[model samples]
Target chain A: MQIETGELINITDKGNNLFHLIIKADKIADKALPGQFIQVYCSEGESYDPLLPRPFSLFRIEKEKGCLELVFRVVGRGTSWLSKRHTGSSLKLLGPLGRGFTDPREFSRVLIFAGGIGMPPLFSVAEVSKEVDFTLFYGARSQGELIFLERWQQMTDQIFLATDDGSAGQQGNIVELASSLLDSGSADFYYACGPRPMLKAVKRLMAKLKIPGELSLEERMACGVGACLGCVCRTTSGYARVCTEGPVFAAEEVVFNE
Target chain B: MNDPRLIVKVGQFSLKNPVLTASGTFGFAREYNRLFPVSALGGIAAKGLTVQPRAGNPPPRLVETPSGLINAIGLQNPGLTAFLQQELPFLRELGTAVIVNIAGFTIDEFAHLASVLDGETGITALEVNISCPNVKKGGMAFGIHPEAAARVTRTVREATSLPVWVKLSPNVTAITEIAQAVEEAGADAITLINTLPGMAIDIKNRRPVLGNISGGLSGPAVKPVALHHLWQVYKAVKIPIVGMGGISTPEDALEFIMAGATAVAVGTAMFHDPYTPLKIINGLSGYLDVEQVGRVEDLIGIAHKKDGLD
Candidate 1:
């Protein structure tokens, strides 16, 4: 992991609280792995109230010039400040931090579950494997919140889209849709990200089907370097840091909830 | 000599400077070693440890407030065995004093941890973490009462020969009483001002932000509260003090020293800048030279007495 100032290339609004930031950070882009994220300092200098860098998963890693792209939602003061920056602004990024997904070639069949903000790293995985038989299960509240569809369509044809209010594709939650798919032939491997409830549903779905996979967790973090115990996730084997030991873990190992 | 006066002594242990990374803030020295040299710090307090492995709290463990953040990590650490097996060797090699911060629910648990690490070759001191507010059982319960705090301190003090530093909570009504109790209980030093109890709620979802419902607040927001506690405790006890809470810069640290803290601990600021401890250490060096202080100890307790400048 490296900490360096990343030059902002552009910021584009994708709709429904989502924004895409493209930065030219050579060292981080070169080593970024799937499921790893960067702690981006949102404010310039030290005049900000929330004095912590917001964690964002790697959406796109362009290895040629060491440039990377991150997509996030403006939920609070940190992200709200981040959305106002223009090209030529520089911010410090500490990454590519945390454990990420392993090689896809190890598994026979891959099923990807991405919930809203979880789409970025799953997108990175799709970009990595050109020949793997993978199906992307993407979910969001509305079509406006579903980002990078055209880009995903270019990667694979087996993309399943679901929305909460029947606003985009299938009705009900994405995990329920993935649960129904498990009623048929099941994939040997699964990868999941998004909110905890969805991950819990997936944990149940994985247990019912006896499938093993990896999960990328999201947590509010400080010292993206894992020095702070702020981003811990509950596991059967003590607490694991989402910033260090994970952001990615054995889907079966992490205890979702009671 | 162009050297800056930076050595700070406490009990039998002497530090390179008075800038140690506080407990729960500096995770066992390995992670931050990648960003900067861990050898640059005066001391490194490992994460709060428990006898049994702790899974900590559930999702939404942290939230940002005005110039601060609330965290209820629930004392997540690999049990002592794994820490002894995995983390200790690395910490021992960090080229700085290694202080282990231990948390327990009972007096026996506290003594058990102290006894276990008592003669460990690398550990320089034992910082009893009786101030954690996140857990329901043994955390802040002991710190809130002077009697309970003294019992915990006495138990650990008897179990270990190493220097003992008792971390105090600011949520108490009178911190000086607890400080004096620990001092009389054989505590070698004290670390003032753990996170203040804090909570936040989401109006849209009608739910509390932290899964634990409430957490300890740290960062710049709690600096005043920390200084107040340090000031009060300084007048009550003769033991050395390590002042902390929302401390970010050299100026903030200097205030603690002048207010009667022999050393200062840096916590929440490390989240934004992993280089904060080193930055403060360098800044202190420059400050000592510019202020023309003969040594770092020369500035201690200046605010409590008459000074050269008004």
Candidate 2:
């Protein structure tokens, strides 16, 4: 995938303290795959204060509009600036980077798992594919953090929600929910993207059930390409770059530390 | 007319230009494809590879200082084998000379790395990193001492016929001695300076900003130091020098050339502007033509004294 510099055209607060930034970059949209991301340069406040741009998975690409979308939560100065930008704000970007999910060949059933911000990238994967026997397992801290549920639910064949507080769907983690489904012989291959712990949990469950899967690891990156040697993951073979070799790696190949 | 023919030979490799991306900054040169074609630049120095694969240190691995950045990535790499199998194919297809930068924990590790890379003909050059302070032991990064530096360079030089460039650390008191040592040991050229080791305190958190307490400081903060090192070593060694550290602008690239660098590698500048190398290359080409410069090599070491008056 090609890495391009993007200009922030408009930043819309998607309310609930979330933001939907419309960044205009044709190169990003043209080259971006499902799970690939863009490192947004929003550290404009202090010169060299926030050293690097924050990495965000691509949400959707609007080619005709000449813009790409990033759904981000304001957790720091970088996202805060991204959330407040007006139209015609130019933001530098390096992206369409990291290996995305490998497109499955004709499988009977596909299982999709996402927790928190992880849902955004999976949304694209689901959007690109056809009407297959697919089930999406989504988990969050509470009902409010179950982001992009309405639209994603409408897109997929089946939707299962699990929140930590039990304030939403099943009162359990997504891994437990997935284990039951796989036990019922409803899943063929699993695809997951989320925080490290959640991914680790799901990977363990997959291994226990002898189910095959692909995982998208979220690592803090420097170059967002293979150059920085900053975002690296240990695998059965050796070290793999999260930016180039993957953000998505086969479950069997990885050796999760924690 | 712009001289698109700024190609020059550095060591045995013939580069399209004298501008190359510094290791740990340019990311295999693919990151810039969205903005410009990477082939437009002279070359790409792959991120530091290691003997065994490294997961690197935990983030926040990077922190921005005044005009520089401190990164303690800990030489995270997927080892040489995986890189060759997975990433090297794509890198070779980019049609630019790929300089593989390898780090070792021991003398044998460096030799093993070179031996493993010997059969990989797609690689244009091998850059030996002996300057990373973030790793444990043999990250002996070769530049710390003249003896250690020469030993590592000589080992790699014996292992492969590929042109070897030893990337030097800037934290040392004297850099020329090490440069001379590597040159005498048969290094094709030298890349200087690696990031200087430094620390930053998070006033609010009242602790260090980097996960690794100390990180390498790069960017504009280290440009003057880079110039000094380049100036000192350029006179001490007859081999070519690729100057880096905190270069961000065309003027900065010119300054390195004036200080006797045959080429300039843009580092922390990549963090700020991903298209910096292209900009520097284009800017240099423009500056050279306008100044009636006949060749890029003429710019190297032009900052000489008037008949030893200085």
Candidate 3:
């Protein structure tokens, strides 16, 4: 993938310090599938304080408009810098990278487990695929942290949400909700992206239930490509690059904490 | 000539320009070719290889600081045979000088690597990694002792007909002594300084961030230290230096060059910006032309003379 410069087309404040950035870049958006991410250089070429580009999964791709949207919360130097980028600012993107979600048998009964910032890529997947009707489990620490609640409500009939505090939906966690949902054995295959603990829990629960699924993982990456080898995740085979080998892997392949 | 020349000579190797990606940062030179053809670079120092495949350290292999990143990857690689079989073929197609960076646990392993790769075609030189701070064994242990460092250099030097580039560690008290020892041991060139010893703590978890506890710190945070060490080693030894540590921009590369580096390597910067080497390379070309210098070699040791040092 070429590192192309895209002009910031629009920036929408999605409230709760979450933002939806629309950049008019064809190279990444044209090839970008759901779950693949772009490494964004938050500033002009000279800045090194936040020395690495932050990886943002594809939130939405407007193919007709030739623009892709990235959703992120203002958490640190990189995101804060990205937040201030105006419509005319130049943004560099290195992507359409990593393996995107595979349909895997057209997954008629799909279960998506998304937590906090993990909702975007799943959102993109739900937006594109009409092949398999799916249920979405959107969760966050609180209602304020939920990025696109209205959209999730509109997307599918089966949207299960959980918040840590009793601000919204069930007052537990997403992995627990996923486990309870899996107990019924409704989902044919599942997809997930979230905090590691939640994913580990999901993996364990899936293993216990003898279910098969794919997970979209997040790691602190330097190069969005495999060149850096900085972002690594343990697997049954060996170490795999979270950037190149996957931001998506079979749930069975990953070896979580004991 | 009105236009400046960017070619630089390091031992028997003649780099089209003086921009080599530091070992361990650029994996086998294939990954970055997807973003940009690495042919524009002067050279590629392929990832640090061992005698056998290493799985590397556990997860939490990396941490980010203010202007640096500490990675305790533990010299993970597919080993020498795997690299020769799987990696070297594609590396040869890149059409740039490929310098293999080899890490060994013993002087004999080091010599064996050099001896084996010596017969291998398409390798410009070998960067003997005696100063990897991330691994628990055979890494920085050889680098801290000048005698041990010289032993590795001498052993590898005897084994290989190809030029040997000894990579030195910054963790030692006196890097100059080690540089001198390697030079006397028949090293053709030197790459300084490898990452400095560092660690980060997760106060919330009440433990070290990296699985290995500590790793070598690289990036702009280590540039000043790298620059200082480069200057010290430059004054101590007569061999050409492939200076690198935290180099991100053309100006940073120029700093290393002015400090007496024959050429500069871009390491951690590659992590941040994959095309940083190209940026620095183009920037150097622009710099030399703007300054009306005929040769990049003129830029070397300029800072030393500016301080009125002999």
Per-candidate iRMSD? 1.6, 3.4, 1.1
Candidate 2 per-residue C-alpha lDDT over B1-310 given as tens digits, one digit per residue, 9 for 90 to 100: 1255577779776788888888877665655655577777788888888877777886667776666677898887678888988778888888777889989888998999998998886898899999988887776445789999999999999999889999888878678889899999999999998888888888887998777898888888888888998999998999999998788788898889888888888777776667778888888888877888877877788896455315
Whole-model alpha-carbon lDDT for candidate 2: 0.80
Fnat of each prediction? 0.79, 0.45, 0.65
In CAPRI terms, where does candidate 1 land? medium
lDDT of 2 by residue, A1-258 (tens): 445557777777766678877788997787788888888876663355455677888778676776788887887677776787788877777777778886654566788889887777877777766566778999988898887788886887488889989999999899888777677366778889888889999889877877788888776566676667666677887667777888889999888775
Residue pairs clashing in model 2 are: A3-B34, A227-B27, A239-B78, B130-B141, B130-B142, B219-B246
- List of clashing residue pairs for candidate 3: B219-B246
DockQ of each model against the real complex? 0.65, 0.28, 0.73
Predicted chain B of candidate 3, TM-score versus the true chain B: 0.97
Candidate 1, residue A49: CA error in Å?
Answer: 1.7
* Candidate 1 vs 3: which has more DockQ: 3
Worst 10-residue lDDT window for candidate 1 chain B reads B1-10
lDDT score at residue B56, model 3, on the 0-100 scale: 90
> Candidate 3, residues A183-256: lDDT per residue as tens digits?
64777788888888888887887778776888888877787788767789989999999998899999999878
Give the Å shift of residue A64 in candidate 2: 6.2
What alpha-carbon RMSD in Å does predicted model 3 have with respect to the real structure? 2.2
What are the per-residue Cα lDDT tens digits for candidate 1 across A103-195?
Answer: 787776788999988889888887887688888899999888889988989988988999988888897778889877764256778888898
Give me the overall lDDT of model 3: 0.87
- The local distance difference test score of each candidate is 0.87, 0.80, 0.87
Per-residue lDDT of B1-310 in model 3, one digit per residue for the tens? Answer: 1122889889776898998999988889877887788888889999998989999988788888888999888888999889889998899889889999999998778988999999999999999998998887798899999999999999999999999999999988899999999999999999999998889998889999888888889999999999999999999999999999999899999999999999999988887778789888888879877888888988887888745434
